[model samples]
Target: MSFLFNSYPLARAALFSMDAEKAHDLTLSALQKAYDCSLTRGLLAAHPQLPCTLMGLSLRNPVGLAAGLDKNGAHIDALGNLGFGFVEVGTVTPKAQPGNPRPRMFRLPRAQCLINRMGFNNHGLDAFIANVRKSQWRSQGGILGLNIGKNAATPIDNAVDDYLLGLEGVYAHADYITVNISSPNTANLRNLQGRDALSALLSPLQEKRKMLEDQYGRRVPLAIKIAPDLTTEEIDVIANLLPQHGIDGVIATNTTLARDAVQGLPYANEAGGLSGPPVHALSLAVISRLREQLGAGYPIIGVGGIATGRQAQEKIAAGANAVQLYTGLIYQGPALVQQCVNALR
Candidate 1:
């Protein structure tokens, strides 16, 4: 293991002593400093080049830093230095807003889980795009997916407009764009997953993508991020709808609202989507069903509860063409990315 990985427990212990959200902020700042000093780059092991294609884009490896880890794209270069084959940022909205009230993030170390209701808090599209353009990640052949969501104040019925706006804003800059309809923290966001509502949503986004592709002379692929708390029928509806709507890929899960895996653990009763080790099986089950329904050769990026190289491999086995991680990075450090890439190789 790299020194960062072996020494991560002490660093994590220090960070875990603070409020979870504050620790997250401080961690990003620290990474920014580390990037400037060109320090943490050496902390990563040799990232085995395990190239794979996802949604018409080539990736250096199948392991990616999931959205939300660098929601504004500010820390992207720093994170990319940690050896992720790709990095997806955002859930950024068309406009910025202070998300829910304070104390929205809770950690349950006993269960190695997190419950957060951070509600798409971000610096909006312009700032997000500027951050993206500042990065050399794509120039280095690193894949980037820009994740988008609606404004917190947007009405659920009129959500399609926000998504269309998001598509237009991010299309030119992204290797792929993720239509995030799955975050449980967003009010009624998951409702967009309904059969007719999803059709209504994807229709306009697809139409807009056609126009944008014509104008930009490039077709940026779009993927939908789904929630893990779905019934089998709901999963089937999404699987059928995405391909029909011209969406090129699917991100198997976001976070889970179900707390069965963490019952009796502290913060288990928190009101928000739950993630981490507890989500692994639920996420795997969703991936399996999505693969069966979407059929072979379709791109599926599995995420949730992956903290080890073996867990990452398990996701690939469950039908994910590639895999992403967020909470795992928090608990296991950046070395997990190298482990996953090596495992996939």
Candidate 2:
């Protein structure tokens, strides 16, 4: 643990010097190699007190690696070894897409935030499923969540088709499926959160889920990832709709378009969702509101700007059943996972 903790500054310095996306890719590749060599598995610490259950899935801990970090499900085993109790991969679409062009990811070191317009760029559902099938983590009892989204080329009216396709493809392999209707990057994706469109989208997916449960002989939970920018009324409306649609859980946020927190900082004007410390308060507010509206027993997975043990505890205090990390991992390293789990315990 000391070696892992002590060495990150040098590693992060090297990564910070490179392009953000390239550094991300290189880091994933290196982590994969480390896991393949069985080096990281022993280095990671596990807390017995961290176990918890949510959405009927038995997680070894409440700390999870959020979606967008491993968008294609390509590094599940490597990431799983980082001591996260669960790992979510993808904002994957039914078809392959290149996402936004290069320089699409920017780092705001001063704010401990990131702004990305990656646009759900992934290698389509088939490849994504294949990668999941190839991962050793599935057999190791790691809880895996697959987040599904519509293709960028698919018109908003036809969005259900892409999600249905993605659901069909990853259903058997995932512990849960996240229907992502909240990404600000995919043009007009957030519009699906409106009352009429949300109902139209979730209704058929709920119906299809029943059929899939029977076919697969298992009931994999379905969760919805929502945006943090929604109004109180909008949050209340969606909160009411979740139980009505039989959705299993709600991931409190994706990212934010608001810039007040990062004002006057570099990349503050970049046109993408802002994450990290800038989103902590807003995400917490959404979680608290959702918990109030959904009532006790509804699962809420809190995310956004959790960089310390106290922040992780705050998410739980705000009524999250579980919590996840992404931007925090960038600034704090893998030790942060252990810290949060210990804090929760």
Candidate 3:
């Protein structure tokens, strides 16, 4: 384990020093190279024992590489080889496009957090599926969920089309599919989470799910990814609606707009959602609330602010069936993944 860090620490630090977006691109390229060289797969096998199951999908473990890390399916094989039990790719849209402008992503090292308004940038559904098809990654005997979203140009009223389009494209390839309605970077996207709007958005999708199952001869679990910024009432409303819509699960809490954890730090006032340590408390609260409303039987994916085993354990204790990490990986490096799996054991 120390050998991996000793061999790659300098490179990782250099990558992290660049602009976060650039660093992300560089990391993707590096992973692709690692996959081709067969280094990443070996690393995954050599790392920790991270094998677990959720939502009827058998994962090598519960610790997963979260969405937004590989916005497109470009590095699916590469990242899958990096010791994650699962790798969720994309906050994909129906159309391929570059997301928000330069300097859109900021790093808060002091607080071990990140602030980004990355606007669901990806190669779109077509490119996303094509990339996934081209990849040799198969979740190392686990699950690979595709996280889908709407286009930035798509209005809240017509957002259903965008999400549905994504679902149609990736449903066959995904072990499960996540409906991303929580990103604060997209204008008015979160409005769809309201009771009436959620019903409108989800009812039709449920109808389509039935049709898809009939047509495809299989059931694809649909999970909703929501924000941590919602009120208790809003959480209750969503919990009440889940079973009604046949929603399979919930990914509790996307990035937050809160700045309390990174308070007074440079870039603390950036205009994107904040992630990492700052979001941990709120995310756990939202998870607990949803758990309370939905009962213990429902599945929830706990995200936000997880940088350590203890933090991951807190999410599980708070009622999350699984935990994901992005900002934590940024701060602690790949060794964090091993630590999390070992701690869980």
Model 2: per-residue Cα lDDT at residue 109:
94
lDDT (Cα atoms) of all candidates against the true structure: 0.89, 0.92, 0.85
For all predicted structures, in order, the TM-scores are: 0.97, 0.98, 0.96
| Candidate numbers sorted by TM-score from highest down | 2, 1, 3
A best-first ranking of the candidates according to their lDDT comes to: 2, 1, 3
The runs of at least 3 residues in candidate 2 whose Cα sits more than 4 Å from the true structure, single-residue gaps closed, are 44-49
The global Cα lDDT (0 to 1) of model 1 is: 0.89
Per-candidate clashes come to 0, 0, 6
Candidate 2 per-residue lDDT, tens place, 1-345, comes to 568765888899999999999999999998887777755656653433467899998889999999999999999988888888899999899889999888899999988999999999999898999999999776888899999999989999999999999899999999999999999999999999999999999999999999999999999999999999999999999999999999999998889999998889988899999999878899999999999999999999999999999999999999999999999999889888889998998
TM-score result, candidate 1:
0.97
lDDT (10s digit) by residue, model 3, range 86-113: 7898999999878988889998877878
Q: How many residue pairs of model 3 clash at the backbone? A: 6
Best by TM-score: 2
